[model samples]
Each structure stands twice: as structure tokens, then as C-alpha cells.
Target chain A: MSQIDLQKILNQIEEIQALFVFVQRVIPYLEEIIRFVQETTPLMEEVSQSILESSKKMPTAVAELDKVSSTTESAASDMLDGIERMLDTINNSISLIDQINEFEKERLMKEKALVLKLAETLDGIEETQAANVKQALDDFYEEYLAKNCLQKLRQNIFCLQNDAYEIMNSLQIQDITTQQIMAANDLIESVQSKLVALTNRLSFLFSASFNVDSSQVKIPASMSFNTMHSIQDINNDAPGKTVETHDSEVSTNEHPNVDKIIKPAENSTCPVIVTKEKQRTNDVNIEQDHFLQE
Target chain B: MQKTILIVDDSATIRKLVRLVIESMGHHTIEASDGLEALSILTHTRLDMLITNLNMPNLDGFQLIQQVRKKYHKQNLPILILSSEEEPEIVERGFNAGANVYLYKPLIPWQLRQEMNKIFTQAKLGRD
Candidate 1:
């Protein structure tokens, strides 16, 4: 235990104190990181819970949409059937009325001829009375049957049948609505896949720290998109595309294959931002260009 | 004059509605559910008019019209578009594809008949 030994002991003591200070400085940062983890854990779990909840609900909603399409189509078919039956019945009625009018009209004309021939043998007031009776018979065919049955009633029925057809035209909305639903289904499916991918990435990143399981929630892959076009990405690709600028309204154009197209309208409600003006390039002729879409 | 017409659309309701109009006018109507179905019918049946919708499954209206235009019967058979596709470029493309007239959906029943009659009259006049 000389002075050199004392110096060695002091150096060792200083090194220990420096190491303690370094650890002391690092402790707050470590505590902050631990606190951040503690705060974010619930938030992450909440996000996972929210995603799980949405994934569960969307499929039920999609099933309801399918029911709506099927039910509407069935109803439309029934309605068309009723309309067709009505038209057939009306046409048959018109034919029957025409046949009856012709027969009754000919019979009335021959009876009037007989009455007039018999009146030639009648004297004074009876002849005029027979003439009046003949006039009444004439009125029955011309005024009563022709005016009421042939002219107005048939015409009205024809107009009514046209009105029924107009009702059928309104059924076009079923197809259009189906298209809109298909478009929505297409979007929802896309969102589902993206969310699933995001969750997978997130789970992989936090596997060591988080209790989140990658398999906890899953969104089913979409079975099919709309049948409006083929599988060409140029032809049938769904959005992330938006409308090119036009007047004040958002563009809802369904054709997505233009060369200069940046995006298509996401929906009626979502306002589109056009970074570049879209040009309807006439170059991508459907005959010449073809490609497969994912 | 009555003429035989082909109504091509994926929607059965649409085809039926158009058929009702044609039949009501004393004309005969044949239907095809898609473009390919239409092509199959066109191979054997002689049509005076072709009423079509633009978007469809297998071969679309544009493709259908193009194929029809290439045939000899296209000279007599006029093509009419009954579609909800209102985009200008798309409509222009339809006309360029050889559609004689383009009609939008939610169509007035009488108006559609009037348009069809007008087309028939024009085609008859053209032949004369």
C-alpha cells in the first residue's frame, strides 16, 4: 500500500463514478421510452379492436347488399311479368271489342234496313216513329259503342300500357344501382386487403413487443369486381384515381383507361383534386391495346 | 313498316322493356344478353336495327359494333345505343363505333319508341 497503489484505487473509483453518471443520464431517456410504450399499448390495442370490429361488420353489410340486388331483381322480374300479362290481356280485350263492334254494327245496319223497308208499308205517324227508332239504333253503334268503346276506351288502354312500359323503364335504376353497389363492393374489398396488409406489416414489426396476433382479424378477399369491362387494368381498374377537372361538379366517369388520366372520381361526396389536367387520349384503341389487371 | 330488331343488353329487364316496345309496334324482337350472344344471333338472323348497351360481360358494345360494322348486313342494320354512359368521349366513341343514335337511360317510354320509329323511317328512306 504505497502511493502508486492509492492512485490505482482512486482511478478505479473515478471510472466507477463516471460509469454511474453515464447510467444516471441514460435513466430518464429509458424511463421516457418505457412511458411511451405504456401509453401507446392501449392505443394500438384500440386500433386493433377497431379494425377487428370493422372487418366483422363489412361482410354482413356486403351480404345484405347481395340480398338487396337479388331481391330487387326478383321483384323487377315479377313486375315485368305482371306488366306483360296486363298488356296481353289488354290487347286481347281490344281484339274482342273490335270483333264485337263489327258484328253488332252489321246486325244493327241490317235491322235498320228491315225497319225502313217495313216503314214503307206503314202509314202517317208510325213511319216517323220507325225513323226515330232507326236513328236510335244508329246512335247505339256510332255514338255509344264506337265513341266510348272503340275510340276512348281502347285509346286509354293503349296509353295505360305505355305508362306501364314507362314503369319498366324506371326499373333501369336496378341495373344502375347494382353497378354502384358493385363499385362500392370493389372499394371495400380493396380497403380490406390494404388493411390486412398493413396489419400484417404492423404485427411483423411489433412481434417482440406487442401482444397483437396477425391472425386475430382477417378481411375476406373479394370474389369478383363489376362485369362492366374485362380484366385489363387499363379497362377495369378501380380507383386511387380521381376525376380530372371539369366544371364545378366532381367527375363520375366510369371509363378509366385514358393515357393522361390521373384519377377518377372516388365518389359523389368525395371532392377530387386534380394534380394534372386529364386528356382523353384517342390512342389506346380497344382493338389494339390489351393488358391484364391485378 | 314492321322490321325485325335485335336488342342486346346484359339486363333482362332492359331487353324485355325494349322488346315490349318493338313488339307493340308490330315488329319482331330478338334478344342477346351480351355481345357474344349478339354475334351468335347476327350470324344467322337478319336484323334491321341493333339496339345495344355499352358495358357488358365478354365482348362489350364497342367490340360488338366494330365486329358488326365489318359485316355486309351493317349496310341495312342501323345501330342504336341505349346506355346510361353519359361521358362525352364514351358517347363519341359509341358514335364512332357506328351507332346511328345514342339514348340515355331512364328513357321516356314514348320517346324511346319515337326514336326507334324515327330510325326505322330514316333507314327505310335511305333504302328507297
Candidate 2:
């Protein structure tokens, strides 16, 4: 080959050498990138599997939440029902007190009339005895002494009338007891209403949290939205009304809707975590309802 | 006619008070500390009327009334529930369980007498 051709060959050899060096330098980086991809492939698969497992548990978690919410609402409703029953009992007791008070008042009035008549009769006796004693004073001193005894007897009769008055006044015990019981009943009813409101709010919160409907939750019939709304309306209309009046309104019956209140466990939309013992107890309650209906 | 009344209560004071009131009404009162004792007495004695308290040991008034209803007709043998429990449900239960009348505790003397008289009158009418 000529010298010029030798030079061109030398240049080509140098270019090839540079290219080879570049490839050699890039090869390690490519291998590192390949290694990194290989390592992350399993990690991506593991992440995808974890996401799939979580997605599978979503419905189960929601179900559990719904169950918990239902249980809590049911328990609260039951407690509210129990408190309402107690309030009804208190109101009945108050009614008894009123009846007793009426009876006692009538008896006292009758006794008072009788005692007044007795006083009138005693006055007549005293007047007659005095006139007779005055007429017989000169003829019979013993009769005068007997007149003194009669006067003392008249005073005793007056004292007896006063004792009767005192006895009549003592009937205030029933009044006071009645008032105390009414106050207690009012307090209990207030607590019940507050509990009802709280239960409603809690049910609403739970329903919202679980993305469910509040109306679907099984609450006491007396603590239903309509009942609460009515109570609120009453309160709003008559803010000055006593708690006793409010209590009277609510405690007039054991449950506003007796049939609705009977089967709360069965009416729940969510799963109830009832034990075997609780199930048996519920069965008994159902049997009692049947018996009552029968 | 002096009727025999069985007064069942847990409190001795209440029993005694009831007995006194019943006796004053010219009725004979048999006392029992609880429903069980009352039941035992009932098994042996002939009672004209039964007055029971709702809250009692051994057996509650509800249970007693239920048991008594199994044997006695409401009209034939009168059962009066005299209890501190004034729940409408309980009252309803008492009446359902063959009770003639339900009277609440701390009862007025005359009111109780009136109720007793009413039951006795009913029983007499039924017998006639």
C-alpha cells in the first residue's frame, strides 16, 4: 500500500479505538441499569399483590364497620327504651300520688265537715249545760262542778278539732313526695331525651361514616326522627313549659310504637354480634311478646 | 263476709302496713315475705284474694302472676298487683297474667280499700 493509504488506515484504527473505549465505558452503566430493573420487578409485583389484598379486605372492613355501628345504635336504643320505661313507671307513681292526694283531700274535707258539725253540737251542749247549770247553781253546787267538767269536755272537743286540722295538714307528705318523684321523673326524662338526641346524632355520624342511611338504623320507636322532631317542635313552641310536661308527653306510653320496639335485633340492617346467651334472651323476649299478644 | 287476702311483699314494714290496712277493712290478711313463700302459702291455703308486690326475691311478681294464671282464672280468684313498679308494660303484663287490678305502692289507704272492694265485688258477682 501507498503511504497515503497507510495514513488513512491509521486514522480509521484510531477512530475504532475511541469507539471501543466509549462502548466499554457505557457497558457497565447499562449492566447496572439492567440489574436495577431486575431487582425492582419483584418489588413492583409485591406492591401490586399488597394493593390487591387491601382491595379484597375493603368490603370486609366496611361490613365490620356497619356491624359495629348497628350494634352501637341498637345498644343505645335499648338503653333509651329502658330509661323510657323507667320514666313511665315514675309517671305512674306520680299518678298514684295524685290519686292518694285526692283521696286524702276528700277524706280531710269530710272530716273537717264532721268536726265542724261536732263543734256546733258541742257548742249547743255547752249552751244548754251553761243555762241549766246557771238555773241550778243555787239549788245544786255539785251540778256546777259537773258543768265545769262539761266545759272541759267542750275544750277537749275543740282541741280534737284542732288535732284533726293538724292531721289534715300532715297530708302534705304525699304532696311533697309526689313533687319529688315528679322532679325525679322530669330529670330522668330529660336524660332520656338527651340520650335520644345523642343516639340520633351518633347514629347519624355512624351512618355518614359508613356511607349508609340513618333511617335504616334500628332505633327505639320513641326515639325515631319523627319523635325527636316532635319533641323539638314542642320544646321550640313552648320553651317555658316545665320538664314535667315534656316528660308527661313522652312517658305516656311504654313505647310509642310497641310493635316496632319489639324486634330491634331482627330489624337491624347490619350483622349483629350476639352471643348464644344473648340470642336465648332475645328469644325469651320474643316469646314474652307473643304471650302478651296472645 | 270477711275475706282472706294474701299480701306478698319483701319489706316487712310494707307487709305490716298492708296487713293493718287490710285488717282495718275487716279482712283477714296472710303475709308472705316473697313470691316463693306466697306460692307455697297459695298451694296450701284457700285465699279469697291475692295482693302481690312486683319486685320480690326467689320469684318476681311477674313470674308469680304467670304461674298463678296457669292455675287460677282471673274472675274466679282475683289477683291484685300492689307494686312500687308502675311501668305501663309491667301493669299490662300484670293484667295479662290474670291480675284483676294493679295498684302502685305508697298506696293511699282508701284507694287500696276501694280497689280491694272492687275486686271483691267482682269476685262475688262472678261467684253469684
Candidate 3:
């Protein structure tokens, strides 16, 4: 062949070899397309079955969810009811606390009122007692020991005795003031009886004139020794010693003769009795005597 | 500047009640459960006056007063003792122990207010 012809033949052989290589690459792509179709068929069937099963289960699941939601809603409503009751209880408790506060306020007010009342009562008692004490002191000075003293004393003493006996008869000893007054009255009565008896005997023996214009005659100042001694004997019959003093001796401070009247005055509230030891013995004797009688 | 008071008591209820009354008068309050606690707080905080109960757990009213006087070395620290025991000797002892005023418990709020006002005014005058 010529050189140009030989070159053309070589170029054609090169083109044919390139065509064979392209054909060999196209065979593998065709086989890959066939393999892809084979692998995708089962996978597509599995996906379709799974979707069908999921779709079928959705309604049942929705029904169960609906039931659960309704139950939860009912539970929430019950909780709301319980909360409402709790609120009511709290309200009642608050009201009760208010009532208690009101009661305490009222009680405090009453206590304040009571304290004021007690103060007023004490003031009244003090005022009344002050007036009574003043009146008693005035009466004691003006009525009993005035210048008409001895005769008045004799009359008042008798009256005091009667009044004392009456008070003792009327009152229980538990009454403190009444018991004290009654005891004083008893002492006045006993002393007054003895004095009255003595004065009458002195009047009889004196046999002297009096300056009184009235029929009730006053005894003469000059009474004899025998008559006064006899009067003393009569008085001494009671539980005390006899005093045989002249009127001169009675006036002297050395004699302290006024104690005849003053001794009873000092012991006016207390009865004259034996010593405490003698009294105890007397009490036991009385008890034994009573038992023997029984 | 507001005046501050220290109230020392074992009872929370009493402390709260006192706080309400004192704070209502535009004053500040610091609370301590007992005298020892009050002594502890006083070390760090400034207080114008003190109101304490007589009977307390850690330290009693007399002991607290003595301790405070000793620590401060000053006579101007006002103490008001409040208690139910009203014996004259107890009141005398409180005054002897450097208490400014002694008062009975379940106190009238108005009376307490007056006393606190008086003591605080005195304290102010002293500081001035």
C-alpha cells in the first residue's frame, strides 16, 4: 500500500478498537439496570405491607387514646371537686378564727368593765365606812361619859347589857363584827347589874337628902363604912376579890382603884374563864362525864 | 435614718406580734430566740434599744443584762424587761441589773408604744 493509504488503514483500526472498548463499558451498565430492578421489587412489597398494617392499627390506637383522655379528664374533674371542698374548709376555718378573735375582744372588754366596777365598789365602801367611823367616835364621847356621867353611865350600861344579850341571841358567831359587839354587850350587862345593885344599897343606907327637885332622889355623898362594906360583900359574891377602900382611897392614884371599872372595860370583849390548862382538864372531865352518863 | 430595736423572746408568736406593732410605728426590728442569741447578734448589728423576756432558755434576763453591760462598758444601752412575774423584788433586781424599764407581760400595746417611744427618745438624746 501507499504511505497515505497505510496511514488511513491504521487510523481505521484504532477507531475500531475504541468502539470495542465503548461496547464493553455498555454491557456492565445494562447488567446493573437488571440487578437494580431485581433488588427493588421485594423492598417495595415489604414497604407496602408495613404501610397497610400501620394504617389498620391507627383507628384502634386512636380509640384507646380517646378512652384514656376521657378518664384523665374525669380524674381532673374529681381533683377540681376536692380542691373546691378544700377551699370551703379553708373559708370556714378563716371564719372560725374571726369568731374567736371577736370573742377574745369581747372578753377583754368585759374584764375592763369588771375592774372598773370593782374600783367603784371599793370607793363606795371606803366612803360609807369613813362616815360611820366618825359618827361612832362622836357618839361614844358625847353620850356615855358626859357630866351627867354616873347616872347616865348606870342607865347606859344596863341598856348595853340588854342590847348585847339580844345581839348574841340573834347573831351567829361567824359574823365577826356582830360577835364582837355581842361580847362587849355581855360584859356591859354583867357589870351594870352589879353596879345598879350597889347603888340601890348605898341609897338606902345613906338616908340623906338630895338636891334633886324631882322625886327620884340622889344619894348623899357621905355614906357610912358599914353600908359600903356591905355593898362590897354583895359584889364580891362574884368571881373577884373585894375592895374595902374609903372614897378618899378611891380618889388617890396610888390605889389605882378605878381599875375596878377599867379591868372589865379592858376585858370587855373576852369572857372571864379559867386558865388554859384547867380548861383542858375540864373539857376531858366533861367528856368522860358524858360518856359515863351515856 | 430609722431606729432599729432588738426583741429577744423564746416564743415566735410573741416576737411576730411585737414586730407587727413596732414595725407599724416605722421602726425596724431584729429578732433573737433567746438572750444568748441576742448577745450573738448584737456583736455584728447595731441596735438602738432592746426588749427581752425574763425567762429564756440559754441566758436569763438578769444574766443577759449583766453580760451586755460588761461587754459594752457603757450604761446607755437601754433594756426593757417584760415578764409575767411581778414580784417587787424581781422588779427591784431588774432595775439593779441595769434595766432601763421593767414591764409585765400581755402588755397593753398603747402603753408599750409609749414606753418604747420614751426610751428611744432618751437614747437619741444620749447619742446626740
Per DockQ, the best of the predicted structures is 1
lDDT of 1 by residue, A136-158 (tens): 76776576554555556767877
Query: Candidate 2: which docking quality band?
Result: incorrect
DockQ in order: 0.39, 0.01, 0.01
How well does model 3 score by local distance difference test? 0.54
The candidate maximizing lDDT is 1
- Chain B only: TM-score of model 1: 0.93
* Candidate 3 colliding pairs: none
**Candidate 2 or 1, higher TM-score:** 1
TM-score of chain A of 1: 0.53
Model 2 alpha-carbon miss at residue A35, Å: 42
**Interface RMSD for each predicted structure:** 1.5, 15.1, 29.0
Instruction: Please give the ranking of all candidate structures by lDDT, highest first, separated by commas.
Output: 1, 2, 3
Candidate 3 on A1-294: residue-level lDDT in tens?
899998997677557445533543443454354345446545644554555455455555555555554454444444434543554454455566566656755665565556555555676757665455445555654553354333444455456544433332222111223223444555555555555555555444333322222122111111122223222222223332223336434221211111121111121211111111333321111112211122
Candidate 3: residue B122 lDDT (0-100): 75
lDDT of 2 by residue, A1-294 (tens): 999998997687557545544543444455455445446645754554555555455555555555554454444444434543544454455566566656755665565555555555666747564444344443444443355443454455456544533343233233334334445555655655555556556555444543433222222223221222223222232221211113225532322112222212222211111111323321111223232232
Misplaced by over 4 Å in model 1 are: A1-34, A123-163, A208-294, B70-76
CAPRI tier of model 1: acceptable
Model 3's CAPRI class is incorrect
Which regions of candidate 3 deviate over 4 angstroms? Answer: A1-294
Error of 2 at A275 (Å): 51
